[model samples]
Target: MNSMPYIDQKGRVYKYGEFFPPELSPFAYNETIAQEYFPLTKEQAQEQGYSWKDPEPRNYEIQIKNNQIPDHIKDVGD
Candidate 1:
């Protein structure tokens, strides 16, 4: 696992084992990028009008199979 801090294009910082996959483009893996773009917290991301998707639990599969969509996506049309 990489121990360096990385920032995504949208300025979200993935510290150490934050588990961000590549191919997201412009993946910043150093302090320089963080200083230049200013990594954002989840709340800050929202305040800046960027959409952030939080991960669901592994049980989400069971919930969906039971026709129980999570509240966050409850209103999403099928």
Candidate 2:
């Protein structure tokens, strides 16, 4: 109704620090620790109304080499 809580495109209202319902959560069951402990197959998880996600490939660029960095705090200068 206000900035304290606002309605989403789906008509759901949310506020910071408030607990969100599992069904309304942004994370898929497979993306959370629940999958690590429970460990369900993709078919099983989706059948139970939980979402699953495929792993994404990540590529990071190395900006600096380890040897190029200063080893001590005092070694760094503007």
Candidate 3:
């Protein structure tokens, strides 16, 4: 699934259709502002014109038959 990227005023990229929490205010679902307000697609937001912040990878997990959990959270039951 290709997620449509949206840039915020702070140059933070947020994928469209994703659940943006209340902590991420000032980011609206208005598509009209995408072109004018935020023209960069996550990859284009560079402060010094060279580096851009990458999104954090989804929770690390090991697939076993069908179960998954973050690597940080160890399962004592295992």
Candidate 4:
């Protein structure tokens, strides 16, 4: 079982084992890609139409506040 850090539904980090599929390991292991592609928290991910089981869980509010989400993304929902 591989050990990795995962963001929970509450935006909390947790240690997960055997949670991801082997085929997706490359994307999962890439920290840069993870930060860019995945949501940093579960709540934000859910708002973006991703399920709880999705690996990417980021807070869009935080991203917007921090100016992480691009103008295009900001325009889409609002």
Candidate 5:
């Protein structure tokens, strides 16, 4: 049996319709709801019907970590 294409919160398509990781499934649905509402707060997000936990904080950390210079760059203490 083939899996359905998973639509992500950002409306991104993944896998055989399944998200890259199942863990992200909730975000996909939540994202869709957020977009439909156009502007939503943490409380509004829930009211609007998003199910996944807030991703902003986690995403921020990821962005910061990704943009940080590698240890090698700082190790030199230039």
Candidate 6:
């Protein structure tokens, strides 16, 4: 980590800029920016051995749900 070449999948991600592959990210693949651009279903993400999380529907009167929003801005309405 210091000056030595890190062996793949050997170092702990203790700091920012240190990262694992998309499949290894602690956050669900569906929750990552990759999902925002290259969308994938729960099945698709899991089939690739990537993490997937089914978020619990919140109980707020009104919530800004970033998850499961429309891919196209045109589809969004007030």
| Candidate 4 structure quality by residue, lDDT tens digits, 23-49 | 334433233455466545656544533
Cα lDDT of model 6 by residue, 29-52, tens digit: 877799999898888877666788
* lDDT, ranked from best to worst: 2, 6, 1, 5, 3, 4
Off by over 4 Å in 6: 1-23, 61-78
Each candidate's number of clashing pairs is 0, 0, 0, 5, 6, 0
lDDT of each residue in 1-78, candidate 1, tens digit only: 355677666566777655554324343223234425777766765565444555556753343554565567767777
Clashes of 6: 0
lDDT of each: 0.53, 0.78, 0.49, 0.47, 0.53, 0.70
Worst 10 residues of 2 by lDDT: 1-10
Clashes of 2: 0
Top-lDDT candidate index: 2
Enumerate residue pairs that collide in model 3: none
The candidate, 2 or 5, that scores higher on lDDT is 2
Cand. 2 Cα-lDDT: 0.78
lDDT string, candidate 3, 1-78, tens digits: 246576655666667567663235444322334537756654453431333334568997765543454456566355
TM-score per prediction, in order, is 0.26, 0.56, 0.21, 0.21, 0.25, 0.46
Superposed Cα deviation of residue 16, candidate 1 (Å): 38
Best by TM-score: 2
Give per-residue lDDT, candidate 3, residue 59: 97
Candidate 2 local lDDT, 1-78, one digit each (tens): 356785555566767776663556688999999998999998888766577889889898998899999989999988
Q: What CA RMSD would you report for each candidate?
A: 15.6, 8.5, 15.8, 16.5, 11.8, 11.7
Error of 4 at 32 (Å): 12
Give the poorly placed runs of model 5, Cα more than 4 Å off: 1-25, 28-37, 56-78
Which candidate would rank higher by TM-score, 1 or 4? Answer: 1
